[model samples]
Structures are given as structure tokens and as C-alpha cells.
Target chain A: MTTADARESTPSSKAPRTERGRKTLRKLLDAAAIEFGEKGFHEASITGITRRAGTALGSFYTYFDSKDEIFRALVDDLSGKVREAARDALQSELPALETERAALAGFLSFAREHKEIYRIIDECEFVDPQSFRHHYETTARRIHERLEEGMNRGELREGLGEAHAWAIMGMNVFLGLRYAVWSEEAAPEEVAELANSILRDGIAPRSSNKG
Target chain B: MTTADARESTPSSKAPRTERGRKTLRKLLDAAAIEFGEKGFHEASITGITRRAGTALGSFYTYFDSKDEIFRALVDDLSGKVREAARDALQSELPALETERAALAGFLSFAREHKEIYRIIDECEFVDPQSFRHHYETTARRIHERLEEGMNRGELREGLGEAHAWAIMGMNVFLGLRYAVWSEEAAPEEVAELANSILRDGIAPRSSNKG
Candidate 1:
């Protein structure tokens, strides 16, 4: 499915089941990401988000209780999507390296499609420490599970059980933030290549390893 | 000399010819680091910084045209200090590996003292593209230079050169942010140990590399 279609496919039975409700919800989320990402959490208001979404002020309360609730939902939803994408890539029949490449590619694709959402999530760590910690640790553990699976299957270099997994995940996030999200010129593919090369070989000289 | 003493001994003239001018500049920088580090560049205000430094609002303008300029000064100054610290450690009468270890230790010490400043620099890349690019490339080149020096002196494994430098720098920064800045429970020394071990020995199974 196209990215927009994928993003729009959210659970709706909890909210109004009408078509208008779904469209309003989608618009609200889009506008909220932009507003929240740009202005930060404390500065963002539900009224501003609703106005930007072109919905009536009262309509906002139908979907969310407060601006904080909207932000919480937005982050939780995006985090879920990112985890699902990573898990799916891991399950695919790519080699270990290719799987990693695809997983990063998937993440970069997600960031590209939802740049504002990614920024909101990235800044959330600083904006809301408790919530960000809960989300970050959970995501780290999930990524670690994937790495452990690769190690158990002898698909990746052995002895790199958990720490290495954390390192790789953290390193990728750092790179994505600096090069892909913040950078204007560098393409995702180039960043991927650089990261992949560093991951596989490390900074040590090949000859030094033999010595 | 103690860290404080060393900072004091560095002639105030090192920054500005006038002692009063230098002190004012230092207050602005100190205030900027705290405000920017805590609230980020966009969120930090000149008024807040001046208040924190106990300087008149007009005096703030006399030193800095805008908050961005203050931020730029802080970043440039921090970057220079980090580089100079690294260089000083490397030049000491230590072996290659020892030199590297010392440099890492110096970095950890700096991180401990200026945790907020480190966060500001890391987040600054998201604030302005040109500023980030200039700092990132200069830092990268400095790292490459250190690695080259170590390799030539037979301190590091051969053939990696600039690539190795980049990976080491990337890994260290990622680890520092994750273990040090993100969570205070992690001591710099402990993170340094884990990282140093990983650097000395690859994550691959020990048996596989028994050449």
C-alpha cells in the first residue's frame, strides 16, 4: 500500500465510525504533527491544531481530550508504525546485512514520509522525559530482539548479543537524525552505505585484525 | 593545576583584551550554554540568558546581536576546547593506544563538566544547516587526523585511516549520548570501559579472529 494509505489505516471503532470522522481525524493528525513538531509540546494548543486542520473547535474534543492527549496519541501511533515496519523487514528473507540495510531503509522511508512526526518523536525525548524514556527503552529492546535472532541463527557475527545491538540501533538513529533528517544534500542511500560499511568492518584496519 | 585554576590562568586576554569585556563575554557564554542546553536554541531567549548572567539587557546586545549569535559562539568555543583537549592528550608521552585512551578519557571528563553544552551541540545541528555543516566537517577532519597519526605510529590496526576515525568518533558519540546524557545512572568511566573493550576487540567471536 502507498504510504498515505498505510498511515490513514488507523483503528476507528473507538471514534466516530462515520466517513467524515475518519477524514477529520486524519487531517487533525497531519496538522498536529506540523504544529507540534514546529512549536514543541508546551507551545502547541488544541485550538491551533484544530484551526490548522480546518475543523470546528468543538470537533477536536471529540477525538482528543487535550493537546497533551493528542501528542501522546500521535507519538504512540507513529512508534507503533515504526516498530511494525522494522519487524516486517526483519522477517523478510534477506541476508543479515541486507536485512539490516532494509530495516534502516524502511526507517529512513518512514522519516522521509513523515518528517514532522519523526522530528516530534526525536524532540520528545527532551520535551517529555518520562514518556520519551518509556518509548525509547521499549524500541531499543525490540531492536535488540531482532539482533539476537540474527546472532542465534549465525546470520550475523556472533558474540554481539545485546550491547552490539544497542550500539547499532543507537548509531543508526544518530546518523538518521544528523544526515537524513537534518541534512539537505545527502541522500538516504549514501547514508545507508556509509553506515553499512562502518557496521560490517568497524574502524579497525582489516590487516590489523589479522595481526 | 586544578581544572578551575587552569581555566583561570588562561589569560582573560585570551578572549578579549579588556578584562571586563572578557568577563562579560564569559558570563554570556556560560548563561547561553545553560539556557540553550536546557531549552534548545529556538526555545532559549536572550532575555533569559541575560537574566541568568545578571547582566543588563542592553549589555547582552552589546555582546551579541541575537540568541543565535550567542549560540554560535558557544558551539565554536566548545568545539575548539574539545579539539584542543584531544590534541593535548595525544601529544603527551603516551603510547598509541594509551594516547587514544587518554583522549577518550579527556572527552569523558569534558562530557561530565559540560553535559548541557554537549546536548546543545548535538541538538544544534537541527537548528541551522550551515552552522551544523561547518562544525560537523571540521570535527570529522580533526578525528581523521588523530586516527591517521595513530595509524602511522603503529598505535592502531592498519588500512582503515579516515574511515576508522569516523567510525570510532561515531560510536563514541552514540555511546556517550545513550549512556551518559540520556541516562545519568551511567558513569562516564563505565561507558568508557565498555566502549574501549569493544574498540580493542571486535564484536565477532574471539575464535573466528585467531589468525
Candidate 2:
């Protein structure tokens, strides 16, 4: 198969036509995460992914054509999982600040469970620059949308725009890197509260209202 | 020379005892930054760095025994430069919030001027993980100290700690990535002001003081 055959492997494309096919595909991606995370992109091999997945070599070819294809696919898969994890935490009619807190808490938990996610996505920078940029840009856009919703509801300050969203995204990402991936000294709830408070009351002294 | 010889090359160690030696070392490091930033760690070669520095190959081996050693040194150099940029932006006795703004603005300007910095520092994660961790840990410690100073002076809130410092650092870094490195559509002062306002009043609406 040509390298272009890998394009059909993504869920958005051909995907797996049968339920069994879908299950096999899921196993393949999960195995790919471990393989790439442990060995990094250069050292990771397609055979390693299939072996970890407990699938035949033909099954691997039925989906991805090469290591690069599966790595890109895995990045997109993790990106979606990050969004889903956050979405699962939110309830309708929650306060703007509370929404952010829940999302971050959920994300931190997800990050801890899948610490390998960080290594894979970071490695994507060298393996697939386009996917790396797309993941962050898309994530930041989601954040910006939430900020706008809060503004329209009269919950947040006016003029909370793209830069504010990017700032908050940065805060969440770095907090995860330090607290979740690096170590577990701090609880996810505690770390989320710290970030949430920044959005709610900021770091200014309470009694001193200079304005 | 043995691999151990590279250990003496750090500025804290041998550090090129003479003025001419120091200048040559600086040129070598600056060239390494560009080479690593452009070609990345794996593709980047020691010869590539020396050629870019316009120095002889002997000079390369004089300071670093291998490409990995020079890459580690380069990460340290960039990390120090980040600290200096923020320090140069500050005037003694500035307000706590203003200090953060000045530091961020300085960082944004630095990122803009040395757009290669992000790639080089990021690649350090794969090439030299210890230096990568050290760079961030050191930066967060510096920011944490500043926050404590603010609290002591009654210029900021109480209970602001390492997590908060990490949050602010994340904001500055992502803002720099989006605005300074990726695009220059927004001014550094403008981005700094936006982040400053978040620290000052947060995104909560003005009329809603339910707490």
C-alpha cells in the first residue's frame, strides 16, 4: 500500500466498518501510545505497536501504513480524549468559574491516568508539527468559545478575548505538567481550586480595593 | 578529550578563564541555539554548530566533548537569558502587579527577538531532559520568590505559593508562544496588560460581588 493508504485509517475517514474492526482499532491506538511513549518516535516501531496490541501484522496494515501515520492518528485521538474528559465534567447552568474548575480537575485526573499522553503529544512536535499546532490551536479555540459564552451570559468581564483564553489554557496545561505528570504531591481538586481562584478573585489583596 | 571533559565547560565550572575564551564560548553557544532550533537535536551535528559560529572545529572540542554537552549548555544559557530579560525590565521598588507585567512584557519582547528560543528550549526536553526540567524548575522558583515578596509587602494576596507561580509562568509562556513567536499581531505591552488585568481583577464581572 502507498503512504496515502494511511489516510483511510482515521475514524473520520474509512474507520472500521464492523464493531470488531473498531475494537481492534482502539486496541491498536492504545498500544501505539505505550510504544511511542516508552521508546519515543524514532525508536518506536510498527511491529512493536501490533505486538503490544496483540494483533496480527495484517490488521495493522488494514489501518495504518507506517509509524508516522499511527503517531499522527494517536495524537488526534488523545486530543479528542482531552476534550471529552473536560466535557464529561461539566453540568449545564454551572457558574463560569465553577465550570473552569471542574474542567481542570477532570483534565488533571485524565492526565495522571495517562501520563504517557504528555510524552506522545510532545513528541508530535518533531514527528508531526502540523498535528502539534492543530491540537493546541483547537484546544485554545475551545477555551475562547467558553469565555465568550460566559461573557454573553453576563457572568464574566467584558472584553475577555482570545488572549485571555490562551492565558488560561497555558495555566491549565502547565499545571497538569507539574502536578499530574511530574508528581502527585498535590491533589487535582486542590490544583484546580488554585487556578479557579485566579479566574474568580485573582491574586490581589481582598481588603485593599485600590480602584 | 574524554566525555568528562565536557563537565568543566559550564560557566559555573571552567567557563573559559580568559576574555577571548569567553567570547568564543558565547559564539559557540549562540550558534548551537540556531542549529538546534532549525535542525533539531537528532539531525543537528557538532560541525554544524562550529560552522554557524564561524569558529574552528578545534574550538568546538575545546569547550564541549560532544553534541549532547553543548546542547545542555545551550539550554542553560537560554534559561539564564530568560531570567536576565525579566530582571532588566524591572525597576527596584515597583508594585507587585506591575512587576509581573514588566517581566511578562520583557519576556514577550525577548521571545519575539529570539523566535528560535521556543524550539531550542522545547527540543531540550528530548535531547537533555535534566536541563529541560532544571530550566522550568529554576524559572518557577524565581517567579515564586517574586510572589512571596509581593505577599510580604502586602501588595498581593496571602497564600499565593508555588502553584500560583507555575500558573503565571504558564500564562506568560503560552502568551509568548501565541503572540510573540507565532505572530506579532498584538503588541507585547498589550498582551502584558491583558494578563495583568487578570491578576488584578480577574474575569468576574464588575457588578457581581456575591462573595
Candidate 3:
């Protein structure tokens, strides 16, 4: 979770200089996520974030000028992590549909581990509308790119575009909310496969086969 | 919009008895939608709602005791309206897949007219967690019931269960947010068709000569 990439993604004007500085920044972002996620923007305070990070109050000011700056940076950080989770799942060259399944599975696992992601991202709609919109728009764009790749490979149907990507993203997001964050009623793979089947063949009944 | 059903759906203890009372209550809820939608729950005030409603302060207290009470009532009111929109579109009998398409089209149009629905419903997650959960769970349950009917009628594939319903619900919600609420870039029918295409044949390439 603590990576140099996380540090680089920080939007603070004063970028960390050394390795220790990067770690401190990472700690602050991680702590900010929890603080904002739990207490929300109105109630969350700078001291609360530093207390959670186990860093001195000065450490917070060194990287972020104010709470709003840190919150914005934390959103960017989480957005990057969401992309990374999908990227990590897409490392292997799988079929178009399997790529989607793997990406959803990665997302479900990530959501289960970091349940606060939903809260923080959701709060962005109120606290920082731009970041909130940017997160989904960016995510949908990434999905649209994958859809194009699938179409070129002749695996997916033609005419799939931005709308289709948004549909897929929506399905994955709600599935994660119900199965991963709310409760572990179904395995991540099972849920992922169920969604994948819909994309593969839909729910239309076969002429000769009966369930 | 002012109907007996609307009044019946109100959770407040003081239900409006006369037509005038009902109209006033409806005004308050409509005004509350705008207020909460723009300012959010925390920042939204009772006076703001009353002022927009063109009702006196005493009228607000007559129907709703506090800002929290009005907010809860507004969520219920919006949820009911959503159901009514779908129900209105479903007057005629159609195939299961077609039924879904009609319902989504209905939702898209409704969302276009009442853009504040998303903001109010999303804020419920923070202000009133139970109501937020209820809104989605209830919507998903309704979708699941429809899938069951489709399965029973041999119109849809068997093994389509709660997960499939959730998938469909998620698709419609996000489609509405992107196409309807954010901007009317695409026609409602077009957005609905893009989603229906997924439910009907999915994104997979079709084989030769398959209906």
C-alpha cells in the first residue's frame, strides 16, 4: 500500500524530497483516507489525521497546506489505487471477457480490504465535486479503452462504446457494494463469473436447452 | 404528482388530511428535494425548504417536525416516484427483456426531469444509512422479482437470480447518472437501447444465423 507511486500521486505543492519524506507523505494520505472515511469531511480534522498517522502535527503541514488539500490528494491517491488494482489483474494476456472478470475480481478483493474507499469517494461528490466526477469519468474512459481492444481482437461484438463501458463499470461497482463491502455472502469469483456470463451470452433462453 | 399514494408514502406521523394539506405537503417535499439536492443534507435547512415551497414556517412544522424528518420523507417520496415511473411504463404486457427496456427508458426520462433524485438518494448514505440501504435493496428486490417472472415464462434463461437483477439495476442507475442527470448528450431511448442490447444478446459477437 505504501509505494513511491502513492507519493508521486500527491497533489501537494511541496513534493517529498527524500525516501523518508515520501513515506511520511504516504502515511499522511493513508491516514487521511481513514479519517475522512470514518468521520466524513465536516467532522474530520487535521490533528485527527496526524494522530492516526502517528506523525507530528508539523509533518502534515510540511506536505499539505490545509485539510482540503490533503483530502483532494487522498482522492487522487485512491483513484490511482483503483486503477492499479485493475492493471495488476490485467497483467496476463487473457481473452476480452476474462479480462473483465479478472478486473472485477481484483476490484471486489480490493473493496473488501479497503472498505473505506466507497465512503471517501462518495464524500467527494459533496466535498469536492470535481474529483468525484473525475474519478468516475477516468475509470469509464479506461474501461472504454479495454472495450476497444476487445473489439479489435474480435472477441467482443462491434459497436461497443463509452456507454457499454459505463454499463460494465456500473455492474462491477454495485456488485462490489453488495457482495464485498456489505457482506461476504458470495465468493468474489462466483460473483465475477455471474456478471461475466451476462456479458458473454446474456439471459436469453436457449431453444433446445432448459435449466 | 399530487396523489393519494404520495401522501400515503409519507413517513411522517402527521399525514395531511385535506387536499390543501396534501398539496402543501407535496410542495414541501418538492422544495426539500431542491434544497437537499443543491445544499446537501448537512447544509440544507428547513427554512430554505419552506421558502422554496412558498409555505409558512408553521406549515413545515405541521407536516415535518425537523429537517431530519423532512429529509427522510423526501427520500421516501423520491423512491416512490421512481417506482411509479417504472410502473407507468409497464402498463402494457411485453416480453421480459422488453419489460426491462421499458422500465429503463422510463427511469431515464424520469431522471432527466428530476435530476435531483441522484443527489438526494446518494446523500441518504451519509445522513440516514438505513433509508439509503432500503432504497437500493428495495429496488433490487423489485428487479429480482421481474427476473423470476421472466424465468417462469420461459422468456429468459434459467439460473438468472439476485445477482443478475443487481447487475441490471446497476446498469440502469449508472446509465441514468451519465446520460440523463449529468447531461442529455444521448437520447433516453438510445441509452436504454445500449443497455438493453447487453441484456438481450450481451456484448459477445453473435454466431451466424442466430435469432
Candidate 4:
């Protein structure tokens, strides 16, 4: 993620004014992800995060006030990164179903590289409940928007709504957990295609009545 | 759940011997769910569970040696209950897709009643990582087995396997999180049918080419 992304993660008052400050803020948040991801919320410390970032304690204080502050910020930062990863994956114009496939593939790839993301985001449920809710709500909203676009284009089924979006999000999240974080037996693209197939045609036998 | 289920949750040596003992054990576990669910693992205390159970501290010890032991048993007990809920929902023979719908509806109903369950299970990732992994892995395995059965019966598509099961599980789980735990905007059957529709026909437009 870039320093620009880092700026959005921090509270405006504490956000970096200089480019160097933004870099340090980004470093601290990235370090916080590793620290919290490895040691968990309670065991993770400001000193540990600073040490990992190779930044001074003063630098950490400039961006974040405490470990809780940094942990919350890290979750927000990671959420933004997740969105960026999917956005980057779909730079090309693709069919509606292919867009979902690309999005899942991007997520799985990101999860494989940053496995700690699961731990950090999961822990946010306890550490900062609001951020935890915000992450999923925002994600589901994005998926819902995509579904609406696909429907409007006469590509996806009509009457799709928030529930379908949540279902798709859940499928992507769990697939990443199983294949990307828990094990690497399946490649990201392979896992994504498998999921996309469900959205494309589902599991019902071809000859079965739609009813 | 029956006393037999409670018996399996605890260590064999610690298993309740008499009817009264089993009842007390179930009480303790039920109370522990509320304690952990409301206060979380770190903050939940043995006394809190015992108090919620309306049993003496000695009775709590009779079934569990420590808070950690009781918490672990609670996760196991809840996992079993989840299976029972799905199984109970399918008392009569159902088409493969209908079976999936019933299971999702049952889970949604169970989740709505035991809202604390998500917190407990999610917290297991931190308090007891093994049980957390065991919960999802076991659930996925059950789903995979069902998919295999459906394929053999010529119901679901032939290539359906573990990935499909995981996808369905993810869909049900996130739908539950959105509609059950977070808000009760939708009925359990209503939510379940929406997911079942996805599995039955997918999100592709009715006239869209399958490719």
C-alpha cells in the first residue's frame, strides 16, 4: 500500500503532513499487522511494533497514541489494501462473472502473501468491534454494488440483493481461509475458479428443474 | 442436547456419571457459553460461569478442572449442537439442494437463538486455536461428505467436491452473521431460501450463456 492509503487510515488530526511522515506511518501500520498477527492483540506491544518497523518510539507516537490505536489503524489499513488488491485485479474490462472471479483470485493471492490478515481482521472483532463491523459491512456493500451493476447490464440474475452479496463475500473469505492461510494445496486462481463456477452455474445437476 | 452429548464433550475421566451429574454438566456448559459470549474469554471467570449456571463452584469443578477446560468443552458442545441442528432440520428425505436449504435455515435459527455462539467460536481463534480450526475443518468435512453423496446420487453436478462445500458453508455463515447476529431484518427461512437459490441456479441471468 502507498503512503496515500496510509493517510486515509489515520485520523485527520494525526495524519502525516510530510511525505516522510506518511512513510513512517505506513511502516508502523505494516509492522503493527505483523506484531498483532503473530502475538495477538493482548501480547502485541508498542515497543514490539516500533522495533519491527525500525522506527523510533517517537515516530510511533506521532502517528498513533497507543497499541490499541495502532492495532485499529492497522485493521483499517489492511481493509483498504484488500479493496485495492481486488480493484487492481480487475483493471481490465471483463464480463460480470469474470469480475467476481478476478476479485476472489485477487483476495486469495493477497491472503496467501499476507496470511496475518485473517488473524488481524478476526482479532479486530474483539480489539475494535466497530472496525470489525465496518470491514464486513463495507465489503458486503461493495459486493452488493457489483451485483447491482451486473444485474443492470443484464448479465447477472435479476432480484439479487444484499443477501447474495453477503453470501458471495462469505464464500470468498472462507475459501481464502482454507486454501490461502490454512494450506497452500490449492492455487489462488484454481480456488477462485472453483468459487466462480458456483456463481456461474451452481452445484445442481444440469438436468434438474430450476424449481 | 442429551446427556450423552454432554458426556462426549468432557474428558472421559471427567464425564458425569449420574443423571444429576450430567444435568449439572450441561448447565455449566450452557452458562459458560453465556459468560464467554458476553464477557469474552479473557474477561470471563470461573465464578461468572458458575454463577450463571446457578451451581456452586464445587459443582463446576466436578465437571471441569478449570475455566480453560470448561471453555474448550463449550466449543465442542456448540459444534455438536450445530451438527444436530442441521441434522434435525432434515428429519425427512430431501433433494440435495433442499437438504442444503434446510441445513442453512436450521443454522440460521440456531444462530439467532444463540447469538453468543459467534462470539465464542470467533474468540476460539484466540483462546483456543485448535478448537477453532477443528470447528471449521469438521464443518467443511461434513459438507464435503454431503456433496459426495449428492454427486453419487446424480443430484448435484459430478465435479462437486470440498470446494463447493466450503463455498456453501461460507455463504450460510456470512448470511447468518449478517441476518442473525448483526440484525434480525430477515427471517431464517427467507435467508436460507435466498442462499438455496444461489446453489440451485447461481446468479447468472436466466438467458445468459452458461459459458
Alpha-carbon local distance difference test for all models: 0.65, 0.87, 0.88, 0.89
Which is the better candidate, 2 or 3, if ranked by DockQ?
Answer: 2
Question: How well does candidate 2 match the true structure in TM-score terms?
Answer: 0.94
What is the lDDT for A88 in model 4? 90
For candidate 4, the iRMS in Å is: 2.5
Q: What interface RMSD does every candidate have?
A: 3.6, 2.1, 3.1, 2.5
**Model 1: CAPRI class:** acceptable
In candidate 4, the residue pairs with backbone N, CA or C atoms under 3 Å apart (3 or more residues apart, or in different chains) clash, namely none
User: Best DockQ goes to which candidate?
Assistant: 4
Candidate 3 CAPRI classification by DockQ: medium
Worst 10 residues of 1 chain B by lDDT: B1-10
DockQ of each: 0.25, 0.63, 0.60, 0.68
The runs of at least 3 residues in candidate 3 whose Cα sits more than 4 Å from the true structure, single-residue gaps closed, are A1-8, A208-211, B1-12, B208-211
lDDT: worst 10-residue window of model 3 chain A? A1-10
lDDT of 2 by residue, A1-211 (tens): 1123223337455578799998999999999999999999999999999999999999998888788989988988888889888988885668788889999999999999999998898888889998888888988988899999989898898999999999999999999999999999999999999988888888889765335
Residue B117, model 2: lDDT of: 92
Lowest-lDDT window of 10 residues in candidate 3 chain B? B1-10
Counting clashing residue pairs in each candidate, in order, gives 0, 0, 0, 0
Runs of candidate 2 exceeding 4 Å displacement = A1-13, A209-211, B1-13, B209-211
Colliding residue pairs in candidate 2: none
lDDT of 1 by residue, B1-211 (tens): 1122212313333345577977887888888889888888777999989989999998777766777777767777676667676666667577655655666666766776778855676566566546556665666677677667767877666655433454566656656556656665666566665555455555444344445
The sequence of per-residue lDDT tens digits that candidate 4 reaches over residues B93-192 is 8988899999999999999999999999999999899989988988998899989988889889889878888898999889999999999999999999
Residue range B1-211, candidate 3, lDDT tens digits: 3243424445546888799998998899989999999998988999999999999999998987789988988887898889889888899998998999999999999999999999899988999998888888888989999999999999998999898888999999999999999999999889998999888887877761154
